[model samples]
Target: MKTSFSSEFAKRYGLYALVTGASEGIGRCFAEELAKAGVNVVLVARREDLLHTLATHLEGTYGVLCPVIGADLASPEQVEDVFQITDQIDVGLIVCNAGFGTAGNFLDGDIDTELNMLSLNCVAVTRMVHHFGLKFKHKGRGGVVLLSSIVATQGVARSAHYAATKAYIQSLGEGLQQEWHGSGVDLLIVAPGPVETGFAKRSNIQLGKSESPDVIARQSLKALGRQKVIRPGVLAKVLSLALSTAPRWLRIKIMSSIMGSMTKQLPQ
Candidate 1:
């Protein structure tokens, strides 16, 4: 994978890649993988300390530049700041991996937290994609990887808003994939199931099984220019296959049940 990435991926996407939420988890793995493949990375996340640490490590290990950008994407102003900074760099790949999920009953969810999640997961992503998508199209060569989730396939009960946000990304990426078919730009949507990230704890959901973050990152990168959508990892593939042929209502029911179990321990 590293050898292929060093040649094919680097040539296709260019020398520099920008990854959001790059302080940890799948985003961090993506940054590491890209750097290892000889691509410079721009790391964006709210944690400046972590970003700096990771940046230093990647730079030292891979001998590639790692620029750290600390800003909360949930804020529209901050998103602009990120754009302005990144605009100065020659980033050929944009990975929108900075998103969070909310679990538990919709009625019991905090309105502010829900809105913030919307801002970060949807509005921020839309703004980033809109800005970079046009830039990439004009450049005639680039890649865009949008992080979605398996729950995006249906209306997850305990995670309704989170699922909706990912659904938006799924639709957007799918549409752009078609629109950019002959435009020299590749758009890939990564809809993975549970992953062993901070997401489960942060979202207040528990999962019995999950894939490693490296699995998600590697698979997504491998599928970037080759496919429009990929449900990475064995668990994600299995879940997608099982639900793909089900009726919409049944899919929803199954997803709802799964989410309910995950969030059942949370406060009502």
Candidate 2:
């Protein structure tokens, strides 16, 4: 991997980054990418074992400090604890990548789980962006990456709540991009399609054509300061464009059908 973008990115922003959901998948990729760029990382997630393991790996691989903070992002208190942990660190970048999905007819699934997803995906993201965003503005330099999904462009079946939460993220990130225009704080909304992660297993559904976590992470870093929104992978770009042009009703129907197929594969 080339150090040109990574090194330059950390230098322009701060040398320290805070990555939520940093134990696995895309979040892990983000932490690794930043560490490669000579940025120290503060990894936040719910699993202590995974967090400590990843922290150790990054520390040894990149020779950069990696602090592991185990916190369930859905809890308001835990979210605040994350901020407190980073309070003393000069965190220049924040990647809000901690979120999950529930797949089933919305009314049929466990409402409590959906609520938790909402809290983690939307509520937690808003708080982090608001708190850390201000710090970046006062300092006049920083970066924020909010992980959204192509499904956010329209409603999808089986995972309506999850999609809706990402929709909030999409709108929030877009608005913040303009709100912080002159604040020297760059915000990148990463709306990628399905990726090869444990999301399908957790959600109890199948997945479609997906990119690797590292692929999405790389595209995000490349688009960091240059673009406000990025749809990584050719397939993701295509899906985004198609959905944007299609009528809402038709788009929803198509997504519903896609969701139906994926859900059908799971054991009932």
* Residue 160 of model 1, lDDT score: 96
| lDDT (C-alpha) at residue 130 in model 1 | 90
Clashes of each: 0, 0
lDDT of each: 0.91, 0.88
Candidate 1, lDDT over the whole model: 0.91
TM-scores of all predicted structures: 0.97, 0.95
Residues 124-198, model 2: lDDT tens digits: 999999899889999999999999988887899877988899999999998888888988899999998888987
Best by TM-score: 1
lDDT of 2 at 83: 88
Stretches of candidate 2 exceeding 4 Å from the true structure = 266-268
Superposition error at 22 for model 1 (Å): 0.3
lDDT of 1 at 232: 93
